[model samples]
Target: MRNIYLIISREYLERVRKKSFIIVTLLMPILMIAMMVAPSLMMLYSKSEQKQVVVIDRSGVVADNLYESAEATFIREDGMSKSEACNIYNEESGIFGILYIGEVVDARDSVQLITNSSSSMLLEESISSQIEAIVEREKLKEYNIENLDEILAKIETNIELATFVNNGATEDDGEMESTSTGVSYILGIVLGMLLYMIIILYGQMVLTSVVEEKASRVIDVMVTSCTPFQLMMGKIIGIAAVALTQIAIWALLVLSASKFVMPMLFTPDIASTSGALLDGALGTVTDTGYIATLFAYLALFILGGFLLYASLYAASGSAVDSIQDSQQYNTVIMLPIILSMIIMMTVFNDPNSPIAFWCSMIPFTSPIVMIARIPFGIPTWEIVTSLVILYLTFIAMTYLAAKIFRVGIFMHGKRTSWRELWLWLKE
Candidate 1:
């Protein structure tokens, strides 16, 4: 027990005191804060460059209908030949382009656009859309209905539907919880990916740490004092502690920056709605309370997933003398992890389907699949069952891995293969 504690302390403190760990831990929060704030700041402060378009309207009927907008200003030039307009356009510094329509504006070949340089799609689309609207309005005059344009203008609508979940409760009150499929999908993907990465990262850390110690003959010296199982357990638990510490610090920094710093970035004009925007963006996107709940489950799944994978990783590491020799083993371990990601993407659209439920019950993929499902408000039994299966599998795997470690720790230069690993397991 004391030896394991010493090993754990040495592993934890060695990593925590490193400059790389300190730098990444501090730097990641600032980068996250930038990502959250950048788009909003750009939308609020970024200005579009104004353009001036010259119009040579020979149709005479069309020039008056063309109007100015935020993107460009249309100036109608009448009583001028196309050549005269071209000359003036060539002499002008600010003339973005010229719109020329012949006596028949409806004829496609009769209309032309001349620009000082290549034109933007936005400018072309804007001009084409306005002309299309005008032609449509003129053609619709065949109906002879009065105020048709005004009626059409008034008919356009924008609707926002707020969704709620309460099993059978009324839409207005009494235990009804507001829900956003869009926001929850985003959260699910983020949390699932977070679990996926930490599992791969820290599990690989265990593998590499074991390979490195064994390669240096340090495991030889260390194993004389403790059993192979104790050494492996100590290393696994110590690194798990390191992973948890990093996650906790990151959550605190990100949440603090979001709650306090981002709101302050809003200008006085938008400061009033800043709270609402910060809370849920477009309102009722998600309840802020779910953040805590989601992260708590994230930690649980990360730890469970790490322990399960790390045991296998430790055994794989013990069987190999160098990191380069572990590639085949690494590929085998990653197969289910990759499958879990694919299943996660498909399951997002229909989280409660039989496929998702069954996949969440599988110990290999449950950490990711279950985390993704949780944001959709899955039942409590599913979460508990998945967790129990994951940890139970971890316990069984550790016992087998410890046996492999005991056999392989003293092995030196001999190359080991999967067939040999199977024989060792049997013995």
Candidate 2:
């Protein structure tokens, strides 16, 4: 055990001392911030390039409203045909586009949009939506509805009901109110991505380290001082510590950036509504409270989940003598994480559904699913149970991996298989 600790320390220090590690540890946060800010900056720059669009409204019902709705100066071409409008729009190179609304826009009516300038999807969508709103309003007017408020009130319907539980207690209007679903989605995505990147990146690191040692014949020298099991444990523990260090740095950077850096990137007039991120907020799509809780759950889930998967990756590395040998087992290690992400995507839609519950309880998938559900305010006992199961699962997986690591590191000549793995387990 003492030998393992020494080996672990050596491995950790050796990797941590590398210049590349230092560079990446610091650069990742900046890269992440750049990725987040680029889209908003691009959008801000694009708004200044708006151009005038000509509207030829033969319908006349929605012309004025559509022009105001488009929020662009409209040159009224009320009597022009589609061809005439297109010709004029072509002559004006700087104009944004032309909107041709035919009489009624009925099944027989022709509606045409002509643009010589490069097409913008956002512009197209906005125009389409505006036209749709005007058409709907016109239809209402045709039905002798003089007032939109009256029409809206007549169409709107509401009903209320209460339910009785098995204990005869009334279930009132107790629907869970969410403050921000967008925040919850971001939380789930962040957790899923963090887990994914950590597992893949560090797991690859382990595999490469093992293969490098084996290829260079350095394991023989290391074996003289430490047993295969000790070497494996040392490598895993050391890498895990490094991962923890990196994660801590990332967490600190995120907290600091959110409080200090974000304001500089975005103006106060257009501050983004996207809120706190982490796994627990996945279900809190409509609630701000969920965003607050997400960070806490995310911290716990990420810590536990990273330790769990990193152990597996390290074990996989020890089991193989070369990168080619490791490739075969990589899918097995990655499957749980991939499946957990797929499960998380649907968790928000139905937090209490049977599929969500089962997946959340399963050890392999629970770390992610439970975190995703936490923002939605799951029962306290469920969270406790999931954590306990995940803890036990981690212990069991690491112990089994350590066993395989002991024998497989020294094995040579052929690739290991499931049968060999089981045999190692028994040994």
Candidate 3:
């Protein structure tokens, strides 16, 4: 027990103190912040650059009604022909394109946009929408509808939807749980991605650590002091501690940035929209109970999922003499994780489907799938059952992997096979 504790301490301190760990731990949150901020900045820049478009309206009825905005200005052709306008427009630096509203028997098919460079879809859509609006207005006037604007205004409606869940209660006896579909979707995806990345990243780290030790013959000396299972457990636990620490730091940095820095960085409209997006992604930020439940599930799945994969990774590392040789074995471990990610997209669309339910219960996939379903409120029995199955699978896998690790650590200069692994397990 003391030896295992000592090994765990050694592994934990060694990794956390490394330059690579320090650099990555600091850099990841900055990268996440950059990812969030860059798109909004690009959008502002794109909107700021005004585009000049020449309108050559052969159909005179549409020219007077063409809309102009800050992003684009429509220049009406006076007496110049289409070819003359194209030539003059091509010479201008800021001009985006030319819109030719040809004789419109059908507005959709007849309107054409010509540009010297690639055409902008936004510009094309705006022009088409304006022309369609004008055509509709003219048809209404021909029909002698005097209050067309008022009628249209009265008919245009915006709908808001509210969702609620019954919390273990009948309609007469229990309170309703208010929720948002957008919030659940964003949370599920975000949590699912986090699980996928953490498992892949740290699981590989465990594998590499074992391979490095075995390659250097450090495991040969360590085996004289402790059993292979102890060494494996120590390594898994130590690296898990490192993962948790890094996650905590990242969460803190993200929280701080969202609360303090985002307002200063973005305009009021952008900031408000961003805030709404974040709230939708995370649920109500002020709801302590919900937030606590989320973190608990996250911790449970991350730990279970990491241990399950880490055991196999450790076994694979023990079997290989070099990183290159590890590739074939690594592929075996990676396939399920990749498959789970692919299936996650389907889960996002219908969390209550049978496929989602079974996937969440399956040990190999439950860690990601179950975490995704939790934000939307899965059954309590399902969560408990999934956790039990995952932990039991983790134990079985660790035991099987220990059999391989026990023999494979001393192996060298030869490739391992499935038959040999089975023999080791039996022995």
Q: How much is 104 displaced in model 2, in angstroms?
A: 2.8
Q: After superposition, how far is residue 96 of candidate 3 from its true place, in Å?
A: 1.8
lDDT of 1: 0.80
The collision pairs in model 1 are none
Q: Pick the candidate with the highest lDDT.
A: 1
Model 3 per-residue lDDT tens digits across residues 1-427: 9888888898889888999999988897787656545544554445645678888877788878777776578888847777887888884556777778777725565777778777666766777777777888777788888788899778878654545676676657635555666657666877888889999998998899999999899999999999998999999988888888887787677667766676566546654554433333322333446755676778788989999999999999998888888898889898889888887888878888999999999999999999989878888899999999999999999999999999999998899987888899898
lDDT against the true structure, each candidate:
0.80, 0.69, 0.80
Minimum summed lDDT over a 10-residue window in model 3 is located at 277-286
RMSD of each: 4.6, 6.4, 4.3
Clashes of each: 0, 14, 0
Best by TM-score: 3
Q: Give candidate 1 regions above 4 Å deviation.
A: 36-47, 51-67, 70-72, 75-136, 162-190, 266-279, 282-288, 342-361, 372-381
In lDDT terms, how accurate is model 3?
0.80
User: What TM-scores do the predictions have?
Assistant: 0.78, 0.76, 0.82
For model 2, how does the per-residue alpha-carbon lDDT over 377-400 read when each residue is reduced to its tens digit?
A: 578788888878887888888888
Tens-place lDDT digits, model 1, residues 1-427: 9999988998889889999889987886576445445545654566656678888887776778888875678878877777888888873566887888888878867778888877777778878878878778778889998999789799868655646666777755556665656556766777788789889988998999999999999999999999899999999999899888887887777667655665566545574444432323322222335555766788888899999999999998999999998998999999999999999998898999998999998999999999999978899899999999999999999989988988888888988887888888888
